[model samples]
Target: MSTVVAVLGATGGVGQHVCSAFRASGDRVLGIARRPSAAGSALRLDLAEAAPAQLAAALTAHRTEIVVNATGGWVLSAEAMHLAHVQIVERLVAASTLMPDPPRIVHIGTIHEYGPVPAGTLIDESRRPEPQTGYARTKLAGSQALLNATAAGTARGVVLRAVNVCGPGTTSASFLGAVLDRIRDVRPGDRVPMTIADARRDYLDVRDLTDAVVRAARAPESTVGQVINVGRGEAVAMRQLVDWLLAAAGLPPDTIDEQGAAVQSKGGDWTRADNRRAARLLGWQPRTALDASLRDMWHDAARRYSEA
Candidate 1:
């Protein structure tokens, strides 16, 4: 039987991928976003401020069995982050309880929630989250809210703490996305200014992350009420990744005018995931190659820039 899936923040990078993954799997997808597009069954709804009754009605009307909370704010103000991450989650949990058969929630979280890990250490789901920035704190709060609802029997919830996701359609604010923008704006002699190039991060293809979400949504009750780390389980230096991207874009090494010197890494120079739980429970792993993902990002960005 085809599952009815409701994807919140459906227009966002990860949300769009999640919606497409579900539809590709032959499931019915209902995309909910503030500015819903003509993709799938679009529903324009502000989940943060929408009444619980109204939200419940929408889910019930669509017969949604699984709801993916992909809405999040990265560089927004603290107030905006709270609204997007925390308040919206609280509202969703409340609304789900109102349904006769509450929909299972798959909350998309970030590795930032784990804060700074030791250089060689891998973060597991058991590690207590130490969110430092407002973004991380707000996202952690949202994940906690969903888990709490599951514990209270108000909802079935699973939190996937994903690492840096890179692929086509990456947001311009992301590290790789920023690099693509820089490449697009680079003139013959202009030097690209970047930050945190020395830091090592585990990057997962957006498609891999979406595959994990689909698996988590279809997982049994035993997999619910748990937090799983979703990532490639390997770390690559930011500088190396940037160099690869530049090379892929047909830019010469000398073309990079690192203004003065490379950006110094702050604390938490490494971020890698321990995907044992994800593999054991969700039966998933990163299948896309990093080089392939970077190539796709370059092509996608170039296409967008040419069209603009």
Candidate 2:
């Protein structure tokens, strides 16, 4: 059946692709943003201050079947993390619940919701969340909200806890983008202070992540209350990814070296997602490889930089 899907945060890194993926899958996408854009039929809505009635009015015009809460800031901002998390997810959930025969809600949370796990262990939904940062803490709360919504029969919901998603359009201004830009600009033998060895991060291609969302949103109602991890089941070290990027750019392996940094700078280690549930339940897998995808993203960013 043809579906109408609403995309909150429709202009951010993952949200941009989420919009494209829905359009590609033949879903009519109504994109919502704090600042409206031409990406789709824009809806002006600010989750933070919008009243419950206002939020319901925003969704009343469209008979949406799927609602994707792609809104949320990645880098820590001035706003309280929990407040930001609750505002976006809550607004959408509230709107969906208000609608008669509400649509299936898809909440885009982060893998950080699982907190810091040791390398080599499979990070799955069954594990209890032990959030280390305020961001993760808020995301965990969002996950709970979805579960609560499902249990209360307010709406059918699914929460996707995603990992580090890499793709084009990232700049030095962004978290990973800054590191990538710095590495690309550095000359051979210029050692930069890095915490690559400290953390094992799970990086997913934005394209592949979008595919998982599209699949999960269309899943059966029986799959409600499921918390899924959408990622490539590969636990790649930060140092390894940096090396891979250097190799892709034809830079020598030792061209960039990690300055023996302090404990806090090194950050936490990571593990890959156990996508068995996503595969069986959502029938999804990442199609893009890290090295090639990074190269493509770098070139695209470089082109954009030159154009600017």
Candidate 3:
């Protein structure tokens, strides 16, 4: 049966893509945002300040069947972590459960939950979470909260631990998005400063991640309470990505800047997603390789840069 999907944060980086994917799949999608416009039944909703009753009313009014909690905030700072990552979960838990039959909740999570796994181990659903930073801790907590809400019959939930998802319209404040902008503006003598992590990790196109979410939402109810990692199984080195960006931009190697600077660690461990579980369970697999995804993002970023 076609489902009614309500995408929270429908205008966000991942939410926008997820909303687009749901529309493509013929699901009835209603975009909920704090700044809604005439853009496909937009509603003004500030999840943080919204009461449970308000949420329930919104869902009922919309007749939603699937709730994609695609809204998420990230920061390298503690205060931002609390506001962006933690409070959102609490709000969702309160608001969604108020519904008569709460919709399936697909909460977005970060790869940082698998914080700093051993240099060689592949991170899958089975790996126990070892959170290191405020960001990871809050995200891991949010994942747990969503699961608890599911077990309590408040809502059915799925958690997607996504990696460096990138695309156009991403903010420079983001790790990969900032890199895309920098690469687009590289001159003949610009050496982009980056860390030298010999570690390998997965990357995903935001759209591909959205595709995985669509599949997961359509997944059998039996797959609820599952936390899946979404990424191409292959891991790419940070340096390799830098080189790929340079080549994709059609810039000469002279534009590559290699300063003798130590790469600052983000206070977490390296980990890669074991996507076999997602593939077996939800039939989800990453369609875009990191190289290809990067190339696509470069074109989009370049175009945006030109327009600006």
Candidate 4:
């Protein structure tokens, strides 16, 4: 039987891909977002302010079997982060409890929730979260809310702690996305400023992350209440990754403003994911090559540049 999936933040980067993946697999998709899109049936509502009863009615009316909470904010303000991550999640959990048969919830979480891992340590689901930034802290709170709901049997919840996601149509706020934006707009000799160039971080293709979420949604009830780490399982230096992106965009090696590329943040200095659980539980692994993903991102940026 085809499942009915509702994706919150359906117009966002990862959310859009999740909706597309489910639709491609023949599932009925309802997109809940503040704006309309081609992904699924539109339910225009700001989850942050929407009451539980309103959210419950929307889900029940759509007969949603799975709810993917993909809504998140990258804002620096603590209040905005809390509203987007924590408050919205709290409301979603409440809505799930009101359902006759509460739908499975796949909460998209961030690897940053684990905070700073040691230089060579591989982080798994068991790592103690030490979120430092407002974004990370808020996301952790939301993750705990989902886990708590599952433990109480009010919802079947799975938290997928995903690493940095990059691909075509990535948002400009992301590291790679910022690089793509610069390359598209700057001339060959023009320099672009960046930070944390030496940080070793994991990057997952949006498609790969979407596949894991879809699998988590369909997995057995035993998978419920589980916190899974979904990532590329390998770390690449940010400097090296930026060079790769520049090359993919056909930019010169000196395009980066070396003097301006000093470390501006320590948030991603060293972080890598141990994806054993995702492979074992969801039979998922990243398949897209880094170069291929960067190429797609470059092409997307180029297309947007032309249109601008």
- Give lDDT tens digits, candidate 3, residues 40-97: 5377888767877888898888888888887766566776677567677777777777
Q: TM-score of each candidate?
A: 0.94, 0.91, 0.91, 0.95
Report model 2's TM-score to 2 decimal places: 0.91
- Lowest summed lDDT across 10 adjacent residues in model 4 is found at 259-268
Candidate achieving higher TM-score, 1 or 3: 1
* Candidate 4 per-residue C-alpha lDDT over 1-308 given as tens digits, one digit per residue, 9 for 90 to 100: 88899999999988888889999999999999987766553889988779999999999998999999988856667788889989999999999989998999999998889888788989998888998877788899999999998898888899999998888779997777777766776777778765547678889888998999999998888899999998888888887788888888788777887554465442557878999999999988889988788888888777877887
lDDT of 4: 0.86
- The worst-scoring run of ten residues by lDDT in candidate 1 lies at 259-268
Candidate 2 clashing pairs, residues 3+ apart or interchain: none
Model 1 lDDT tens row, 164-256: 889888998777887888787666666665553657899999999999999999999899899999999999988777877887787765666
For candidate 4, the TM-score is 0.95
The per-prediction CA RMSD against the true structure, in angstroms, equals: 2.0, 2.4, 2.2, 1.6
Candidate 1 wrongly placed segments (more than 4 Å): 187-190, 260-267
- Choose 1 or 2, whichever is better by TM-score: 1
Residue pair clashes in candidate 4: none
